[model samples]
Target: MLKTLLVQNYALIDTLEIDFHQGLNIITGETGAGKSIILGALGLILGNRAEATVLKEKSKPCVVEGTFNLAGYSLQDFFVDNDIEYADLTTIRRHINPAGKSRAFVNELPVTLSILKDLVSQIIDIHSQHQNLLLADGKFQLSVLDSFTDNLQQLASYRDSYQKYRSLTSELENIKEKASQAKADLDYLQFQLKQLNEAKLKSGEEIELESLQQQLSHAEEIKSNLQSAFTLLNADESSILIWLKEAVSSLSKISHFFNPAEELQARIESCRVELKDIAHEVEMQNERVLLDPAELEAVTQRLDMILSLQQKHRVSSVDELIEIREKLDVQVNEITNYDQVVSQKEAELEKITKLALKQAQEISDTRKAGSKKFEDSIKALLTQLGMPYADFKVNFEPLGELRPQGIDRVTFLFSANKQMPLNDLSKIASGGELSRLMLSLKSLMVKTKGLPTIILDEIDTGVSGEVADKVGNIISSMAKSMQVINITHLPQIACKGSHHFLVYKDQEKETTETRIRLLTSQERITEIAKMLSGEKISEAAITNAKHLLGSELN
Candidate 1:
C-alpha cells in the first residue's frame, strides 16, 4: 500500500505531499482542479515519460516520490534480483531535470526505467479512462480469463514448449537449405578431391624436380666439360701429373748431394699424388654424366602437375593445396551425414510439438471448465452495479495455429437487454456500462492477483444516482482487500471514502498552484456540499450531503 506521495516542481504543483490510508482514499475537485496533474506526477514515479514542460519552475528539476509499505507483498525476491536493498518501507523516486533527462531510484538505488516500471507495475495498477478500452483488446481479454482460471504456470509451460518447437523447426529448415546448396556443388567437389588424390602430392617435390630438370636439360655441356678436364689432367702429353713425376725424379737423384734437393723431391711427390686423384674423379664424372630422356620427361611431367594444381587452387605451394583438400573432405562428410542430423532435429521438433499441444490442451480445458463460473460471477456483479438485465459470456474459438498463450481465442460478449442479441462488448457497451464492467472485472481480479494498490481515475464517470452508489459500493468493498484511491467528482463515490481529500487550485500573486489536503469532518461536509450543489451550497444540499455521507458510512 502507498503510504505517502511527494511531488515537487511538477506542473501546477510547486511542492505537494499527501499521506494515504489503506482503505478507499477519495480525491474530489471540480474540473481542471489539477487532479490530472497529481496523477501525472504519480505516473512519473511509476516510470512514465517526463517532459520539460511539466517543470513548474523551468530552472529547477521536477521530483516525484512515493513511499510504500511492502510487508506482505513478497517482493524480497524482486529486490534481490534487481540488486536493490530490501526495506519494509520502500521508496520509489523519479527526477526530471530541466533538460528533459529523467532518473529513477528504488530504495535510493538508481535503476533503469524499465526495471522500475516492471517493479511498480507489480505493486500498483492505475486504471485511467483510456484503459477502459482494453475491454476490446483480445490479448487483454485472454489475460483476464487466464488470470481468473489461474493458468499462469500452465501458460508458461506451453510458451516454453512452443518456443523450443519454433527453434527446432528453424534449425531443420536451415539444415535442409544447406544440404540443398551442398548437393548442387557435390559433383564438382568430388571431382576436385579425386584430382588432388590422384596427383599424389608431396612437399618439396616441385623444388627437387625443377633442379633435376635443369641438370638433365644441360646434360651434353656437362659431359663435354668433364671429358675435357679429364684429358688435360691424365691423357694429354704435358699433363700435370706427368710433369710433377718428372720433377720428383730429378729432385730425388740430387738428394745425395744436398738436403734442400731432398725436401724439393718430397714436395713434388705430394703434388703428383694430389693431381692423380683429381684426374681419376674427373674420369668417373665423364663416364656417369649421361642423361636419359625418359627420366627427364617423367620429372618434367611431375613438376607440371604440381604447378597446374597450384594454379587451379590459386595457391603458391603444395601445402596450401592440402588445406583445400581437408576442407572439402569436411563438407562431403557433413553432406553424407546430413540426413541423420535432419532426422534427429525433426524428431525433437515433433516431440516438443506434442508436449506443447498437451499443455495447450490442458490450458484450454481449464479455461473451458472455469468459463461458466467466471461468466456467472461477472453477471452477478454487473447486476449489483445497476445492470440487472446484462448478459455476459466468455466465447472461445479455435485459434487454428499455435500461439504463445494457447490455441484458443477468447471474446467477451455482452447484452444489456434480454430481448437484444449479444454483441461484442466494445461495440455494444456504453461508457457508463464499460466503467462498471471494468470495475467488476478489477474487483474480481483483486481476489486472484492480490494487487496492493489500485488508483481509479474517475471510474465513476458517466454514472450517477443509484448506479453511482453501486460503483462507490464496489470500490469500497475492493478497498477492504487492498488500497483503493479514487479520483472522482461524484458526490456518491466521494462520500463513500474512509478518507477524503480536496484537490483545488490556489492563486498567488504570480501563479496558480494545485494543492491537496486531507479534509476534516466538517471540511468533508463542505466539500461534499460543494460537490452536491456547486459553488453555491444550499441548505437542502448540506442536509443531503450529510445524509449521503452518513448513509455511506453505515
Candidate 2:
C-alpha cells in the first residue's frame, strides 16, 4: 500500500506531498487540473524516464518519492538479494537533476532503474487506459491464466527442464559435428600414425644415429689412423714400449746405489705400464673400426629418414614427432567411439525432454483445471458490472514444440452480447468492453495472493450512471481485500471512495501551479457536487453527492 507521495519541483507543481491510505482512495478534478501531472510524478517513482523539461524549477532537481507499507508482500528476499536494507515501511525515491540525469534510491541506497522498477512493480501496479490493450497479447493472457492458477512453481520447473533439454540438444549437435569432422580426417590420421609407428622412433635415437653416421662416413680414415698408432706403439722392435722398458731397467740397476734412482725407476715403470695399456687399446680400436660401405650407407639412410620425418611433421626433433603421433592416436580412438558417445548424449536429451514434457503437462493441467472457475468468475463480475449476458472462456491449444511458456497456448475468448458469437477478446471487445473486462480481471486478480496496491487512472472512462455506480461498487469491493486508488471525474465513483482528494490549479503572482488537498467530508461533498455540475455546485448536486456518500458520510 502506498503511504505517501512527495513530489517536488516537477512539472507544474513546485512542491507537493500527498498521503495515501489503503482502500478505495479517489482523486477528482476538472480536465487539465494536473491529475495527470501527479500521476506522472508517481510514474517517476515507478522508474519511468524523466527529462529536464519536467523540472518546474530550472535551478533545482525534480524529486518524486513514495513510501509504501510492505507488511504482507513477503519481499524480504528481494531486498536481501539486492543487498538493500529491508523494512516493513520502505521508501522509494527518484531524483532527476536539472541536467536531466536521473537516479533512484531504495531506502536511501542507490539502485539501478531496472531494480527500482522490479521492486516497485512487486508493491504497486499502475493501470492506465493503455494497459487495457493487453487483453490481446498472447503472452499476457497466458500470464494472467498462470497467475490465476498459481502455477509459478510448476512453470519454474518446466522452464528448468526446457533449458536443460536445449542444452543437451546443443551438446549432441556439437558431438555429431565433431564426429563428422573427425571421420573426414580419419584416413589421413591413420596413414600418419602408421608411418610413425613403422619408423620405431625413440627419444634420443636421432642424435645417436647422426653420430653413428659421422663415424661410418669416415670409418676408412679413422681405421688407418688407429693402425698407424698401434704399429708405432707395439708392432716394431724399437717401439715406445720397448724403449720405456729399457729405461726402467737402467733406473732399477742404479736404485740400490742412490735413493733418487729408486724413485726414478718406479716412475719409469709406471709410464711403461701406462704406455702398454695405450698400445693394447689402440690395437683393440683398430680391430673394432668398421670400413664396410654397406653399413655406412645404412647409417646415412637412417639419418636421412629421421630428417625427412622431422621436416614432414614441422618439428625440430624426434620427441616432437612422438607427441604428434600420440595426439593422432587419441583423435583416431575418439572417431572410432564417436557413435557410442553420441548415443549417450541422445539418450540424455531424450530423458530431459520427457521431464520437460511432464512439467509442461503439470502446468497445462493446472491451467485447464482452473479455466472453468476463471471463466465463471469473469462472467459473474461482468454481470455485476451491467453485462449480464456477456460470455467468457479460456481457449487452449497444444504447442508442437516446447517454449519458455510451456506446451499450452491460451487465448481469452469473449462475447459482450447474446447475439455475438464468442471470438478472440481483442477482436470483438469495444473500448468500453475492454475497460470493463480489464477491471473485471483486476477484481479477480485482487483476490489472489501477494497482489499489490492498484492505481487506476480514469478506469471509469466509458461508464456512467448506474454502471458507474456498479463500477465504483466493484472497485470498493476489491479494496476490501487490497488497496485501490482511482482517479476519476465521475461523482458516483468519486463518492464511493473511503477517502477523497481534489486536484486543482492555484494562481500565484507569476505562475500557475497544480495542487491537491485531502477533502474533508463537507469538502468532499462540495467536490462531488462540482463534479456533478461543473464549476457551479447547485443545491440539487449537493443533495445527490450526500446521497451517493450514503451511510459512511463522515
Candidate 3:
C-alpha cells in the first residue's frame, strides 16, 4: 500500500505531503481545487510523460515520491529481476528537471522509466474515467476474461509456443523460396556442365595445340630451306666437305717436307668431319618436313575449338574453365538435395503448429469454462448498482489462423434493458453504465490481481443518489482486501470513507495554491455539510451530515 506521498514544485502545489492508510481513503475538493494535479504528480512516479511547464518554481526541479509497504505482495522477484534492493518499505521517486528531462529511481537505485512503470503497475492501479472507454477494446476484454480464469501459466506457455511456431513458419517459407530459385536455374546449370565435360579439356593442351599449329602451317618453307643447306654442305661433289677432303690429302703428301703443313691438314680434316655431320642432319629434317593437309587440318580444328571454348566461357585458360566446372558440380549436388531439406523443415513446422494449437485450445477452454461465472458475477454487481435488467456476456469468436493473442477473439456484449438485444458495449452503454461496469470489473479484478492500492478519480461521474451510495459501498467493500483512494464530489460517497481529506485553495498566499488537510471529526462534519450545501453550512445540512457519518459508523 502507499504509505506516504511527497510532491514538491509541481503545478499549483509548492510542497505537499500526505499519508494513506489500508482502508478507504476519501479526497473531496472543489472543482479546480487541484485534485487532478495531485493525481498528475502521482502519474510522474508511474512513468507518465513530464514537461517543464509542470514546474511551479522555474529554477527548481519537480519532484514526486511515494513510499510503499511491499512486504506481503510477493514482489521480491520483481526487485530481483530489475536488480534493485528489495526492502519491506520501498521508495519510488521521479525528478523532472527544468529542461524537461526526467529520471526515476527505485529504492534510491537509478532505473529506467519502463522499469518504474512496470513495478508501479504491479502495486497500484490509477483508474480514471478514461479507463471506462477501454471496456470496448477487444484485447482488454480478453485480458479481463483471462484474469478471471487465473491462467497465467497457461497463457505464458501458449505465448512461447506461438512465438516458436511463427519462427518455424518463417524459416520454412525462406527454404521453399530458395528451393524454387535453385530449381529455376537447374536447366542452365546442367547445360554448362555437359558442355565442359564433352570438351575433354586438359590443363596445358591449348599451349601444345598452338605450338603444333605453328610448325604444321610452315612445313613447306622449312623443308625447302633444309634441302638448300644440305646441298651447300655435302649434297654434291663441289660441296665444302669434298673440297676440304682434297685439301687434307695434299697436306698429307707434304707432311714429311713441312711440319706446318701437317698441322694445317689436321685442321682441314676436322672441318670436313663437322660438315659431313651437318649435311646428314639436314637431309633427315627435309625428309621429315612433308606437308600433310589432313594432319594440319586436325591440329587447326583442335586449336579453334579451344579458342572458341575460352571466348564462350569468358575465360583465358583451360584451368579457369576447370574451376567453373567443379563449382557447378557442387551446385547441382545441393540442388538435388534441396527437396529433402525442405521436407525436413515442413515436418518441423507441422510439429510446432500442433503444439501451438494444443496450447491455444487449453487457453480457450479455460476461458470458456469460467466465462459463465464471470458474467453472472458482473450482472449481480450491476443489479446492485441500480441496473436490475442488465445483461452481460462474453462472446468468443475463434480465429482461422494464429495470432499473438491466440485463436480466441473476445468481445464484451451488453444490454441495459430487457428488450434491448445484446450489442457491443461501445454502441449501447451510457456513461453511467460504463462507470458502474468499470467499477464492477475492477472490484472483481482486485481479488485476483492482488494489487496493493487503487486510486479512482471521479469514478462517480454519471452516478448519484442511491446508485452513488451503492458505488461507495462497493468501493468500501473493495478496501477490505486492498487500499482504495477515491476522489469524489458526492457527499454520499464522501461519508463512507474510513478517513476523509479536504482539498481547498489557500487564498492567503500571494499566489493561489492547492492544499490538503486530514479532517478531524468536527471538520469532517463541516466539510460534509459544505459539500451538501455548497459553501454554506446550513443547520439542516449539518444534521444530515452527522446522521450520515453516524450511520456509516454503525
Best by TM-score: 1
Worst 10 residues of 1 by lDDT: 545-554
Per-residue CA lDDT of model 2 for 190-278, tens digit only, reads 99999999988899898988888888889889999998888888888888888888888888888888889888888888988888899
lDDT score at residue 48, model 2, on the 0-100 scale: 89
List candidate 3 stretches off by more than 4 Å: 57-59, 186-338, 507-512, 551-554
Instruction: TM-score each candidate.
Output: 0.85, 0.80, 0.74
Q: Assess candidate 3 and give its lDDT.
A: 0.91
Q: Write the per-residue lDDT of candidate 1 for residues 205-307, one digit (tens) a residue.
A: 7778899899888888999898888778889778778888888888888899888999889888887888899899988877887778888899898888888
Residue 419's lDDT within candidate 2 is 82
| Winner on TM-score (1 vs 2) | 1
Candidate 2: minimum summed lDDT over ten consecutive residues — where?
A: 443-452
* Residue 252's lDDT in candidate 1: 83
Superior candidate under TM-score, 1 versus 3: 1
Q: Can you give the lDDT of residue 160 in candidate 2?
A: 89
TM-score of 3: 0.74
Give the winner by TM-score: 2 or 3. 2
